[model samples]
Each structure stands twice: as structure tokens, then as C-alpha cells.
Target chain A: MNFTNNTYLAEQLKIGNTKAYDYLMHTFYQKLCAYAYTLSHNHDTAEDIVQNVFVNIWVKKKKINPLFPIKNFLYKLVYNEFINQYRKNKPVEYLEKKYFEAVDTSVDNTTKNIEKLIKIVNKEIESLPPKCKQIFLLSKKEGLTHTEIAEYLDVSTKTIEGHITRAFKILKDKLDTEGKAIFFLLFNLDVFSEIKKL
Target chain B: MKQVEIEKIIVKYINQEANHKELEELSGWLKKNENISIFNHFVNVEYLTAHNMGNYNINKAKAAIDVKLKANKRKQRRYQIKRFSVAASILILFGFVTLKYLNFNTANQPKELSKKNNPKNKAILTLGDGREINLEKDKNYSSKNVVGNSKKLLYTQDNKTKTNLSYNYLTIPRGGNLFVQLADGSKVWLNSESKLKYPDKFIKGKPRQIELIYGEAYLEVSPSTKHNGDVFKVISKSQEITVLGTHFNIKAYIEDKKIETTLVEGNVNVKKGNSEVLLKPNQQSITITNSNSIKVLEVDASQEIAWIKGVFSFNEESLENMMKTLARWYDVEFIFETPKSKKYLFTGVLEKTNSITDFLEFIKATSENEISFELKEKTVIIK
Candidate 1:
């Protein structure tokens, strides 16, 4: 199955092809189940939740927009399924920690886009200057602070900050130019608009 | 605060390091919901990478899902969907499209691949002496510091000679399998129809390398600890597996759609084109030859390495695919007398020690006699 080509897959799934459905389920079952487990903390419920999301997908597949990120749709369904159980059981509560986080419905959709984008972004990231890619991965993947990244690389904090800014700028440009089709698929008008203003 | 400062504050806020005032200010900044979404993008980027999402039972989950799908259909399936499910599966389907698209010429369904006369120990080993030796089980051959005992070929390297590199090849035909040990003490279990070109000896200060010209091979690489941290690299047509010391299986058959490298132990870097996927133990990386797309997945490594144990282990493998694989092992042709039987799913283990006819019988029996097979000298007609 072509992970990047849902246009082809969407047609297959819409036709009630269980083979295609099996492929999709087989590809995503483990990851989504594990992700559900993290939220529900109940093994059976996690498995049930993941299974329900897929069952619902097979049933309601006709209503789904093929142009959209199907994987993101799957993840959103998984999230909703877990939340449905959470509402019923109340076994544990979501502790909103100290982080002043922003919630976006687009965030989940962006995740599917990010998965496809990772390959392109990684290729583009590799072509960047060594220190630049290093700093970008440190900030993004490792969640390192500018001061920590600078200390690790033995550079000034200003240099670290500069590298990060340039890294995002370069990534943004590359993604915009080469990743136009993917950008549209990943971002709705609102999120895309917000990104441009940023 | 400026936009960049707002971004910094959001990052600080997400990291849980912001003071109360900074948090209050960040909350105020997020009053415009658009900014919140943009901020969520970065937060999501962090979330996607930060989780160690563990493994789950794929077969068990799929069975559960399949049951649910079937149950749902029984209850309330649309009429159009029911009709389409019976026909129009014209999508080339999965990575394995051998017979080409039937839609191009629906009149010409695939017919008569070939005959099967059963597999035996047959291989060709070309020595550095330019001598070609035909290998069969219990058949011994020795020449030019190389000796073979039917199943395995042993190379005794001439270390004192001043040389760049000397190469030898062991080619296993479509119905043949071979085992060999290279000069570096690395053990290789070559699957049927594989061509392995290995150097007669390792260089003084270089990595040990071998090329799998085509087909599959399981390798138990000699540890770098004994060889002074030297890396061993296996190169196929489009992909390369580089390892320090690990047990891994490489299936790069030309007949197959994708080149799959499944790591059983240690670590390996499966490099194809400019992309490199580092595979931890029990993970499998598949590289599609046509599109150059690579997919990495966690697999049951033992199932992949089952051929080494002379057993077929599958988890819900399709009948057509399983027969396609079985055809190579038993060296036979599969004719689907009933095409629907091709779509039948089978699971569990079948030992290779059984005769090809017996295996087909077992399959027929296990599928509740719903599937029948006509076993001949060279063809097994499936019904």
C-alpha cells in the first residue's frame, strides 16, 4: 500500500474492499492501539477503542473525504473513541499540567501531514548545513532549549537561536515551494493562513 | 511581546518553565484562536516524536476488526457496497502484482506460469580458480583453498599473499538452497534462488562486505569485537544493510515486489537512495523497488526467520501469496481451479519436512475442506 497515495486507496476502501480495509487496519493497528492504551490505561478498553475506530471507519467510510489525511482521520477517531470511554468510566482524570498549551482541531490533522512531510522534511533537513540541521533536530526532536543546545554544541546562545530561526525559515520555504500539494492536504485554510502570518 | 517573543513564551509555556506572569501573558496572547492553532502545530510536532508508542498484536487486532466489519455488514450494509464487494477489485492490489492488471485484458486471465518438479540441493559455486562446482546434498567438492560438503562451502583464506581482493560466488537456482561460511567466520544461510558474491578474505584495514545479487539470505555476522570493530555490509540491488555484528535476514528477490530486510538481533542501517532507516532488533524495513518508497514496521521477527528453521510460519497470509511462496520452495506451479480460493486466509505453522503434496493436503484440511487441490507431477491445481 502506498502510504502517501490515498487517492488510490480511498477508492479501494469506498468500494467495500475488505482487502484494502485489512491493509489499512494491519498497517495502523499496533500504533493506534498503543496510543489508545496511553490514554485509557486499560488494556481491554484500549484494544476495544482501536477496534471500534476501525469498525466505524469501515462503516462510515462513504462519508469520509478521500482528499483529506486518512491517517489523521484515523487518529482523530481513536482520540474520540478513547474520550468516549473516558466520559463513561471516569477511572482517571486528565490532569492539565502547568503547560499553557494551545488546542487546535487542526493539530491532529497536521499530524497525518507531518508523517508524510517527515520524509521530505528529513531529506531537506539533511541538505542544510551540518550545524543548522543539528540545531534544528535538537530544538524540534529533542525539545532542547537554546541555552542547552548552545552549551552542548559549544556555541553562543545567539548563534544557537539564529540557527533555529534560519532552520524554521528554510523549512517553511522548502515546504511551501516543493510541498504545496502536501501543505494543502495537511493544513486547512485557517491553519495555512496562520502559518503564513507567522 | 512581539510575535517571536510570543512564540518563545508559548514554547516556555509548553515546557512548563514559564512563571505565573508569563503564563498569564501567554494565555492573553492565545485570545486570538488562530495564534493558538499555530502554536498547536509546534506542540503537535513535539507530541508526535516524544511518544514511545509500544507494540500490539496485529493478527489478533485484525481478526477482531474483521469480525466487527463482518458483523456490521450483516446488520446494515448498503446495497451498492454489497454489489461492489463481489466485483471491481481491479486495483493492482498490494506490492505483489506478478500477472499484471487483469483490467487491461480481462479476456486474458493469467495462465500457466510453469511446472514444478520439487526442490533439491542444487547450486553453482564459482571459485577464485575459475572452476565452477555443482553442489548437491552430501556431494563434496574441494579446490583452490575452498572445500564444500554438499550443504556448506568453507573458504580458507590465504592471509600471507599480497592481494587487493579475491571474489567467489555461490548461485542457488530457483529450487535450490545452500549454506556457506565466508573467510571472516560469518555464517550465511542462502535461501532458494539466491546469488551471493563474497570476498575470499577480508582486507587488513577495511570493512567486510558481501553482495546479494538477488533472492534472499539470512546472515549471522561475525561480531566486530573479534574483528577489531569492523563493520559488515550487505548490498542488494537498491538497498544496503550495514551492521557491526547482528543476525538479520535480507529478502531481495527480483520476483518479489519489495526488498525486505528484517533484523533479528543487534542493529542495522538499511540504506536506500539517500534515505537510511536504522532498524532495531525485531523491526523490518521494506523498500519498494518501483517507487523507491521505504516502509519500516515492527514485525514478528521469528516468523520472517522461519525458513531458517525449515518451517512456514504465517499470520493470516493470503492463499495466493502463501502458494506463491510455497511454489518456490516445492518448485511447482499453482493453478487456481477456483479463483475464490486464492483469497482464503490461513494462519499457523507448517513444517517443510512434509512432502509438498502433504502440505497441500494439510492446507485443504485446515480450511475445512472448503479448498481442494489437484496435485500432479509439476502442477497443483487449487479449487
Candidate 2:
């Protein structure tokens, strides 16, 4: 009954508690479906993908690791299932033309890949010059307007913009060299354009 | 191409805003295998962030999975029984005991008296010509610029040539709820016994205005940046809410003296007469009808907008106030047998799709028989 504790819920699932399964479905069904729909685009296909994921989780409950966060596990399963279906339904010519061999599509590897890219970006941001880092954090992390950040820093708005732009340029260049194209894909560069418009 | 220029093109392409030239450039860049991987990852991240889960029938989806799960269980049960007969018998016995315990705990669960008492997707849409259309589940209605299916009414973003605004009113009756998508893609979820007045099409370069005539509504306003920097405004009797783009809930029931506006995401300005206050995320502004004062408080914004997610979440709300909300949604009247029972406090989350009896059972059980309910027709007499 105590769903707040993931370990307890995992134990209950392993012991064959229908209520625990029901609670999981109620909590995460829609969100996972939304994630799947983003990949599949079709309503029925998304529902089917999510349903299959849930069924597999229950069927393999004995192997469920209590240490793993169930939410991330469910998402990984849904992503892998979507990829499986995509490869099956895609035209052979399209599959041949696009190379997916370079990508690590394994469940654990894909999640780790995304996490690694984020870690690299964070490290790069941490190494920025003090003023540039402060302005960048204010504009992006705190979601402050240019004027607000300038007021806080006691500087002209143009200076604030310059610092943010410089920070983005440095991070982008560093991340591009380190993680290749995947790093910028993870980093949000929209703040740069917002500053430019202002 | 410069890195920033290519990034901009990729962003536009993922957003489906890329022109032919941009598309050609993107395709040319994507010709490289590594660039193709980057484009795919970019699309995945963009879609994952931008896409809101549109109105999907959760109950229907749950039922579909329920059928599949039951079949899977049966198949597994057959295999388990064949492999370990003694263990399977023990499990069956344990399941029987657990079922008995559950039944005993819910012993006094009331039978649903009538299906009419259940809250449903029913509303009255009054067009500009004063014609009323009944919108309900399984019913469909469509016009040149509008479409109504099931519980949602969607206005297409077209007809930019129109000069004068033609307003429409959506009145949700007691025991009913509705979802409306405005012409500018802003979404509004109306609770039971609520009415919203909005124009058929929001003009470009003009602030989009709508009125929550009465009752409660949760809105996810489309960002003003998308519509030529035109802001969205929601007006009620007590106050006006101005938004650039935000998710907020407004409760302005006719019977209640206080009008509450809770900001969930982004920023909103609450203006009452000349006084205005800007609200941050998780902040709520309460405008009293008798006074011009606006009081701001931090609240769990998710709980305030739980109705849109088919939940009734209350935090130490008085029994009287909670009953009022239940009465509106169930289309039933509550008569307290003793005034003391009205002050009983409740803090819990209940599913909106559950019958009134289930709710009463929950309150009764939690309150330790401090309060009880007697159902007769559409009246719930609380004792």
C-alpha cells in the first residue's frame, strides 16, 4: 500500500501483488504513453508499445531489481520497444540508407549515453570564467530575463548578453569536441537566441 | 555553415518550421551518417520536451491493458499449476484470504443507486447566434472552424480575415466537465457547474481575451510569442489575469466570495481594479469580492489543478467546502444534519471517476464515523 517507497513497491510486485501493479499503471501509464506517442506518432501504436512494456515487466517481476528506479526502467523499456518496432516496420531501403550501427541501442547503454552527455555539459559549464558562468546560470538555470540578470549583476544589459553568448560559445565548442554532435543535442541553446532577439 | 546557423536550422526542422531552403540544407547536412544520428537525437529531445500529452481516455486505455494482463495471468497460472501444484494451491489459499480481508475492510461500501448521479462529459455550447448544442460523450459536432467530439471542443486556427469577434459560451452543467482548445491553441479545462466565454477566433496582434463567467477552470495558455506577441487575458468578476504564456487555475464560483488564481508554470499578473500583483510559479493570489485586497500564498499548484487530471486533491479542506465541490460535480445537494459535521476536515486524494458512494465511504472510514452520509435521490444528508 505504501507506494511512495520504490523498494517496497518492487518487493510487492515480486510477491505478486495486483494492487501494486495497479498503482504503477495508474501512476505512470499516461506519462509513458505520452513518451511512446512521441516516438510512434500513432495512438494505437503508442498504447500497444506501453502495454507490451508493462506486461513484460510483470512477467519478469522476479528479475526486477529493487535498487533501480522504476520510472527510468519503464522509460528505457518503452524506448527499446519503440526502436524494435521502428526497425521492423521501416522500409528496407530506408533502413539500408541510414546507418544505426554506430549508435548504442542497448537499454543500459542508451540511458548511460544520455547521462554521460549531460555530465560532460555540466563539467564544461562549471569550468567557465566566473562572470560568464554567473550570467549563464542566471539566464538559463534561474530563467531570469536579461534585464533582471543585468540588474542583479549591476552591469549593462549588453554586458550580460555578451557574457551569456561567450559562455554558450565556449560550452558548445568544448562539448562538440568532447561528445561530438550529441552534446549540443542535449544542451539547450535557446537562451542564446532569446538574448540575441533582445 | 556556421555551427550556430546549422543549429538554428536543425531547431526549425525539428519544430516543423523549416522552409524548403532550410529543409534542403538540413537534408544535405544530414547526408553524413554522423549528422543523421545528431538530427535523430535532436528530434527525439525536442519532441520529448515540447509535446504535451493531449486528451487521451485513461480509463479506456487502462481497461485495454486490464484485459491483456488478465489473459497473461491466466496463461502464467496454468504453467505454474502444472509445475508446482502444492505451491500453486498455497498461493490460491493465500489469495482467498487476502480477498476476504479486502472485502471485510470495505464491508459497508454503498451500492451505486443510480447511474445518472455519476459525473460525465456533458455540457451546453451556446454559439454566437444563441443556438445551444448539447455536447456529450459519443456525440460529434463540427463547423467551419470548430470541432466537438466526445468531451472536447476544439477551435481551429484559421479565418485570420475576420474583423469583428464572434463569441461562444460553453456552460458545463452540474455533474459534468469539459475541455476546450481555443483558436490560438490555448487549452482550458472547465470543472462542473462552470461557464467560459471565448471568441470564435483570436485576432492576430491583439490580446486574446476570454471570460470565466463562473465556476473553476484550469488553463494552459499558448505562449504569446507564438501569436505575434499578443498576450492572453482571462477575466472574472473579481479580477483579470494577464499572461504571456502559463498554466494557471482559476476558481470563481458564484456562491464563493473569494476568487483564487493559482499559477502552475510561467508567470501571470492578477489585476483587481488598479492594484496588480505578479505571481510566480507555485504562487496563488486570492481576490476577495468585498475588498480590493489580493493575498498571495505559496501552494502545491499540481493539487490545485488536479481536476484536469481526473483527481480531487484536498489539503485540510473543510467538510462543508469539500461537500460543495462534490455536490457540484455529482449534481447532488448536500444537507448537513448537524452544523458541527460541516467543520470536519479532510485531506486526501480521490478519483473523480469514482461514484459518490465511494467518496462517502472514504470520508466515513477516515473520519472514524465522526461523519456519515445518507443518500436519497440527488440529496446527500450528512450527519
Candidate 3:
């Protein structure tokens, strides 16, 4: 039941443990279906694509490599199956274009490196000035408005706004351009819009 | 175009909020082969982060996939049998020998008492229109607003405006348990011998309410912030619990005089008559049915909700109370031959999956042979 380790889960899958399969399904099925939905646009088609990926995993369990992260493997499989379905309907040239895009390493790298970018942002947030960090968390995490944070901290609205603005500036400076873009994408979009207003 | 501006447009496009001009710009940018990868990454990340935001019927999808997997398994089995017919015949000869050995081993052991008293995922779901459905393991039930399988029931959110709310009741009989996720995404784990009545769908801008008719239930309430600040309330016989967002357990067995509400996380207000008390994490409120007095105590919250996790955990609880809890799960009666045996306190954790005899043996050994039990049919006589 302790399948927190992807390597162990991969081994279990290879050894034909149904519990491991169920665990994988329960954990990743929803997210994978959502990802497939983005590509297929229809719910039933998306489900079929993800289901085929899982069925193939079982049918080819012997070839499972324990070292590879199961999450990325699942996403990659779902994407490949989606493309295969697309190939059956579209012309060869269109399919070739999508096939190349599908196999693009940069695209895979961007998603694979998302965890690293998130960690760097977390480190920057932790290194922020105490008052600025407090204001930032209150506004972004606690979903508090500037006035609410001011009242809670017994400070003027102007002071609370100053702390948040300073925190934003510090985070922006610490993160690279790509990191900044990903940070905006991952975090609250409202915060990004607020930065635009500033 | 700058990468940041392009990324912003991609985000907008993924969110379906891009205007005609922005869409044109995105399509133009996506014409470059390299730019398509960036757009794909954004899409992947969006899907990962906003997973719960989707309106898709995930339960239905999972059920559909399960059917496909089952069919695939059958196909694989048939293919394997065809491919290894000769090896399978020799294996079947060894299997029969092994089966004989297993039967001999089991015959030498004591009867498996747990087989009859095993708790199962079973319930009776009464729909809004008074239709009753028996739900058990591997059985599937679906309607317009709800879908349920063996272990859990899910009420899908209906986006239409409704003037009146229709209520459905799930009753967990003895030796049975059920889990239900409400239309608002709040989850309720109904313990054995419990019944819960909840709306088919929660109306926006109105307080979401549910009632526990006469049993125990652990509720993880979806936050009001997710539902336009609509508060959730749990009504029982003696008290009403109001929650903004929280995980709590309410035990209000009809046979018991007190209704106990244990808070696991977040804050909840337990209102009894005119008096209301706010409970924090690790705090519990016990309200006696006959009186207006409510007692607040500090206790281990995990022990209170251990039933949901397939364990019976006690902290110096009396043998009588322990037996009552076990009786609900095992669907057996406990009779005390020696009245003093009922007063003996026991503090230990017993796995629900274990047989009744195993628990009795453990308690007997722990009591230094002071307590003994005899299993007669469905009743355990304590001496």
C-alpha cells in the first residue's frame, strides 16, 4: 500500500501485482484523463485514449523499467496514444507534423523541468524578507485582500501593499525569464494580472 | 514576439479566454515548429495543475475504463491458455495436488469465524423519487444526477438553476459501510449501521445541508470558498454542526444517549439548543441527548476516525463500549456472563480485517485470562 516510491511501484507492476495497477489507476487516472481531454476535446475519446494507454501498460508489463518515473511515463503514453488516434483520421503530412512535435525533446523537457522550477520558486519564497513573505502568503495563499491583510496585521493598507510589492520584486529578480513565465503560469493568474497593473 | 508575451497568450488560449486577435497571434506563433513544443508544455502543465477544475465525469470514465480492462484481461487469459495448453495441463495436475495439501492444512486449524462476520462495502441507496437500490461490491448504479459503484457513490454537479432540492438517503446496514461524495465535492464516509440524507445537488448561494438520521459518519466538507461561500451544516437528533470547511466525525447512535462530534481539522460550531461551542482540531464536543450541557475534551482525533481506516483504536475504553463498536462492524451481539467483565477497560488497536476470535484471544491474553469469550453462532458471550 505504501506506493509512494515510483521505482517500487514499477517493480510491482512488472511482477503483475493488481493492487499496484489499481493504485496507479486511482492516483493518475483523473489527471491523465484531463490531459487527454485537452488533446481530444471530447470526454469519451479522451477516456478511450487513456484507457488504451493503461491496457498497453498491462499487456507490456514485462518491459517496464523501474528507474523511469511512472508519472511521466503515463503522460507520455497518453500523448502517444492520442497522436496515434489522430493519425488514423488525418492526412500523412499533418500526422507527420504532429508526430515530430510529439517526439520533441524540448517539449518533454519543459514539463519534466517544471518540478525544478517550482522548487527554485519555493526556495526564493523562503528566502524572502519575513514581513514581505508574510504579506505575500496572506494575499496569495490565504486569499486575503489588501484591506483584510492590513486589518489582520494591524497595519495600514499602504504598508501591506508595500510589503507584497517588495516580495513580488524580489521573486521576479531571483527567477530567470523562463522561471518567471512558469511561476506566473503555475501560481495565481490574478497575481500576474495585478503585476501587470503595477 | 517576446517569450513572456507569447507565454501569456498561450495561457489565455488554454483557459479559453483569448480574444480573436490573441487567437490569431497564437496560431501564427504556433506555426513555428519550436513554438508548438512550448504551447504543448503549457497545456500539459495546465492539465496537471487544474486537474480538479475539470467538469468531466471522472467516476463514469473510470468505470468505463474498468470495463475495458476487464475485457482485456479476459482476452489475455484466453490467449495465454491457447499458447500454453500443454504447460497448463501439467500445471493443473500440480494445482490439484496443492489444493489437496491446502485443504488438509485448513482442516487441522480452527474454523474461520471471520468469514461470516466480515464487513463489506454494502448499502441501500434511496433515491429522490423513493426508489431503493441495493449497492454491493462490483455492482454499478447510475442515474441522471448520481453514479455509484461498490465502495463509493458520487453525485455529479448539475449546472442548471433549480428551485427545489431533492434529497437522497444512503443507509449502511450492519456489517456494511459506504462512502459518498456530494455534488459540492464534500466527502462523507458512513460507518456501519449509519444512515445519511443529503441533497442530490447543492444550489448555489444557499447553505448546503445534510442530516445524519441515526448513526456515525465522518465528513470532509468542501470549503465554502469553492462554493461561493455557501456554508455546510450537519443536522443530527441532538445537535447541529455548522462548518465553513472542516474534517470531522459525528457519532450519534440512536441507542447511545450522547452525540459526540470530534473535529479533525479546521473549525466547526456544534450548536445544541441555544448554546453553541466552536471546536478546534483535536477537540471534541459531547452532547447528551436529554440535556443542554455540552462537554469539550482534548483527545487523539485519529483514534476517533480509525474506523474509516479499518482499525478499532481505543484509549482505555471500557469493554462494554468496545464490544458495542465491534458489534456494529461484525454484526454480532455481545452477552456478558460475568457483569464485571463488561467494566474491564481495554486500550489497544485491533484490525477490522481480523476475525472476532483473534480479537477475543488478544483481549483475553492481555487481561491475563481474567476475561474469556465463547462464540455461539453470531453472539459472543463474555465470561
Give the DockQ of candidate 1: 0.11
Q: Candidate 2, residues B186-244: lDDT per residue as tens digits?
A: 99999999999999998887889999999999999999989889999999996999999
Q: lDDT tens digits, residues B16-56, model 1? A: 44678877787676666577655655454334322322346
The residue-by-residue lDDT of candidate 2 on A81-189, one tens digit each, is 8765444333444322332321222223334354464566567677889988887666544546777888997999767656765665565456447655554654545
Off by over 4 Å in 2: A1-198, B1-114
TM-score-better candidate, 2 vs 3: 2
Q: Which lDDT tens digits does candidate 1 get at residues A28-53?
A: 77657645654444456678898988
Interface RMSD of 2: 10.3
TM-score of chain A of each: 0.46, 0.46, 0.49
Q: Say which docking band candidate 2 falls in.
A: incorrect
Ranking by lDDT: 3, 2, 1
Docking class of 1: incorrect
TM-score per candidate, in order?
A: 0.48, 0.49, 0.48
Candidate 1: deviation at residue A56, Å? Answer: 25
The number of the candidate with the highest lDDT is 3
